[model samples]
Target: MGVPRAFPHLKMRQRPVNISNFKGSTIALDVMGYVVKGHYRMMKTSGLADDNTLPDSTPGVISSVEDIVRTIVAAGCVVYLVADGKKLPKKAKEHAARAKKRENDLVMAESCFQLGLKKEAKKYLARSTVISPATVDSLKGIAAKFPGKCFYFGALFEADSQLGYLAQNNLCDLVISHDSDMLLFGCPKVLFTMNTKGWGFYYEAVDIPTALGWKKYSYEKFLKMMILAKCDYVKNIAGIGIARAQKIIESSPDLSITSILKTVTTLFPDSGIPDDYATEFDEAYFTYLYSAIVDPMKMESTRISPPPLDLTEEYLSFAGYVHSREQTLDIVLGNIYLDSGRPSRNVTDPSNLDELFPPECFFNSMYEHKKEVLEFDVDGWEGPSPNEDDDEDDERPKKFDCVECDKTFDCLSRLLYQTVTHTNLKAFSCHLCKRTFGYRQTLELHMRIHGGVRKSKCDICGLTFTRQDILTNHMAAHNEARPFQCDQCPKTFKTNSCLHQHKEVHLQVRRYQCENCDLSFKRIRELESHKSTVHYKARPFKCDKCEKDFTRKDYLEQHCLAIHTSERPFVCEICNKTFNDSAGLRKHAAVHSEAKPFRCDICPNMTYKRSDHLTRHMKDTHPAKLEEFMAKKKKAKRPPATSTEEPKKKKPLESTSKANIKIHKLSPQLAKLVGQSMMSQIDIVNKINDIVEEKQLYDPNNHLYAFGDQDLVNVLGVLRFKIANVFNLLNRHLE
Candidate 1:
């Protein structure tokens, strides 16, 4: 038989060491937390964080890494980076599920933040190294940064129940969470404190025993208790609690869970069988135990999680200044260095550049320094020796393999990262979930499914979810969570309630009527709504008629070509039925489809009119094919004689020619219609109010322009000039 797997007892010794003892600590953070934030920010606009009435409660737990970094740095610890191996590329998918769940607005923002952060991190990263779980490489970016610093990865000990059992067995340091389940799991020294700062942290460390507890669990007994309670993952006991389960297990010890299960089955033969009952229970229980005992591997271990924080708390005064710089390349490199914990020397100490000597003086200084050694580079000023060409004839560039591309290339990390990460390269894949990741840390998060560390879970439904903030949004749907009320209607929603409530006016019974026009609407919102309310869209849909704006392109097209482009495409094949429009052709085709649509009001005259005429003719005259031929013979079928020419069949143009041709024709009148600017009306009121200046047309004394025959003509010319000038000004302003 194959060796059955045995869960290991993974435990650590609890030292309760002081923070001062670990002064030179180096921490390696996985980027899972940061990626979560990136993912969250990318979704904020997708109705996820909508509502001004409530504070923004978006998922940004991952970004908490930034704070961790600052805290660690302030504590005088050196930080190191270790990139997990890139995941292998995955198959191209037409229906990428992650892509579908994403909103258009967010994808771009996430991309921007991820790119910027990655670039900045690369600049001052004291040490850069790559490591893979498979390969036994000793090098680590964090370890390399400070060779002597004590190494501690943030997730050194995970939330594993078996580990808690082991911690109990080992009298380990407190589990820093408030979950009561740890007590049942057998974790000793559960400390409910270890916050980021202040005297409480120090006090807890010095007085550790006050928060500490002793070990208490017999493994076999604990397992038996869990099973009897129907709490062991495999069973489905509808109404069992810890207290009831303890009594059952207390009454019966040394009973194998499997045997107990068999007894229950025999006693209750009619009970529904659990699907894969044995397999299911064993898998869940053992799986949980194994994760506690084992450390999961992550790709690109170098990334740090994002700062889990309130945006207002982490706000910056000078957020973005790199874009405006004298030297763009320098600024980019400088920003990268700053983010990576390095301050540029030039920016810090300008005097290091030195007083400007003459160019020759500077050159001479360099020459003097070199000459002081009494050696010159002139010996190597020669080109390749003639002897080298005779020995071997090779003048090609040397090749190097890139880990990212898996191809030979020049050593350009930027190009490699771009080709591999920015594109659809899957550098990491989660063994548990089968999800691809750019790096291993991301995959590490996915692997957490196997470990069962649901840090972020749904609170409202008690359903465990992966992302914490996603649960926040889901909870909003459960109650009267929407506090923002609409001004126009009784309806209330979390966001955009006002606009939507106003839109409801269009649907209500018509109440507001346009006094000047016959048109009326149920609500004032709709009645007051003008075509220009489409604002930006209206500007883009320039009409091809007298200078005008339309909210849609189809409407603009109809206005432009209604008279000239009104040609019918659909037609009836029988009786040569045709129509100038599609509506007529649609009506005519129904006649053929139904065979006859006309009804005869007279006796048997109800037959199709065409058929009735034919029948009458057949009875009155010869109706045979021979008679039809004779009738055709009586009429002369003349050939065309105009220009003595045959009507040549028109051939379709070549594909290239068709592409070159413009399909639609726009009349000058249509062009004029669209040329009118949307802004022309905007500046009129302001312009009118600005000027009380007297014009020749306006009399200062009468406040009116009374004109003679010649004055009228002059006034007409002035109006034309003013209108033309307005259009010109609008064109300039728009441009």
Candidate 2:
């Protein structure tokens, strides 16, 4: 739902990392989703929902937040727990849709209960999750336990935008969330799908270019594509998905949003695009680019980016309205509840709140009104009311504009008919599969696939499509009439647009240049691979099957195919020799050629078709010289280490101060050893130094613990006393 399938589409950039990797760094966590999930789990397990309202799941929500925050803090990270404060006006449509869904789920749950399906009833009941103000207040109590280690922030609207702001401004080192909207909000680093077992998928914004196979990285183009792919704020053009949106963006001139939209409209002329699509696109763009976030340091509300001087007031409100400083502080501090809009000024003073109202009273009355509204409206709910002017305007012969899409019509009847295309409510449903569609035409189109009634059939592939244009596009694939060919490379395309896109590769400026050799690549990964393989000779990618390592991931994959896999997909045309990969087959084909391009340097008479054969000839024919040759090759593989730059000299140990010894609480046994002979002191000091240097017991950078052999002989006495104490405890336990 968030840019649809964005998480899976970015699988290439996702890295599985342990939670401990962020040790000693600040992380901002979005806890609202976990709140809903925890409530569902509790409702499902306990099966104690009251009237299917889940009034008892509040404790489970609190426990969930506590568990998640404590788990992260235990891993040595300082967590900034961020929760949603209020709903933004831009998301009102989405909120209504969700409310309708919950209402429908309630009806389903009630029906299941009547039919003696208790388990199914509970399952449907659990999906009706609502995060309330009481949940946010409970987070304050959880944060209090850890003090500086865990700080809570109640966002003005969305927690993801707040988390993104924290990450972008370096207020936090990482953001822990599964929301793809964080990517659109410009969070530099996000850890998604993390579990309590300390593992998660990680992605960085800089990896987008390499992961998506783009010649260059452009956040503007990426955001545009994600918007066109569909988001919470706007509906996407029909028939266009992530792949097609990317193609459209890449092909557009000047790489502007307007041009991209124009391209989309051209590609999908009858896709029912909104008449005011340009405005919606801008709103979605600004919503991601300049979301309102509370500054953790300043404790005040502010937008992520400064608004343009020429920007309108309406666009500015997309970030959220600015309230008084006191109101903003109260909201950010979790004094105001998110959903009910109730003020709990005494929340910070728990002693007063408990005296005024019992703790159970505060929670038990949390959502009683919400439950009543939902239960009463389940059957009689008729959705939101139509505009009051609809009936009056129908009598006049005036221009009518559909409110959802802004499409104008001469008559109100025509406008009402077209408005159905954009509304979420569905009246017409498929009889065969019981699927609903907003329009009858759409339902009929869906039925064609189920009925196998495709009208347009292909002559060559024997495949059929519902529409002529789709069939025409499919026919082009089998046409094989590539009249347009690339002059730079041995490639051809059926269309001029495809050929033009291919030609761009030749002209693409390689902006990412290697610092070591100045070799350029169109993408950052290529530059990274060149640096790792050609300059550093670092083999970081390793094969788990054979323990063979390579400098690049693709090289490791190829090695796995050639060694571990039995499937041979590529075959040599001349000798019929099969290989697991195309590169191996190509190498094998060279053996059948008359030309021998590779000649051994040590043995000039020996010639071979492959470089590896020449290397083998040199090794077998001249073993002694081959050793020297390998040494030279290895030396050339990596840049020579600079000898002029001297290694960092270790600082001489300072004398241990009395204050440190007192703070560390030296044992009486250590004091007894300190009063012994100088010879014994020196012996103990040397042994202690050996242990310290070998095991790295003390921080090398800590001047207070840096000890000199002559001045810190008592250190060994202290260590011996501690070791003796441990053994004594073990001995006592054994008895």
- Estimate TM-scores for all models: 0.23, 0.48
The residue-by-residue lDDT of candidate 1 on 92-200, one tens digit each, is 1211323332322133323323444332222212111111121101222222234333122212122334235334433222333323334334444332222233001
* lDDT leader: 2
Q: What lDDT tens digits, residue by residue, belong to model 2 across residues 199-226?
A: 6666778778876789877888899888
Local accuracy by lDDT, each model:
0.34, 0.63
Point out where model 2 deviates above 4 Å: 12-14, 48-55, 114-116, 349-735
State how far residue 565 of model 1 sits from its true place (Å). Answer: 77
> In model 2, how large is the Cα lDDT of residue 457?
78
Q: Which ten residues in a row have the lowest lDDT in candidate 1?
A: 1-10
lDDT of 2 at 40: 74
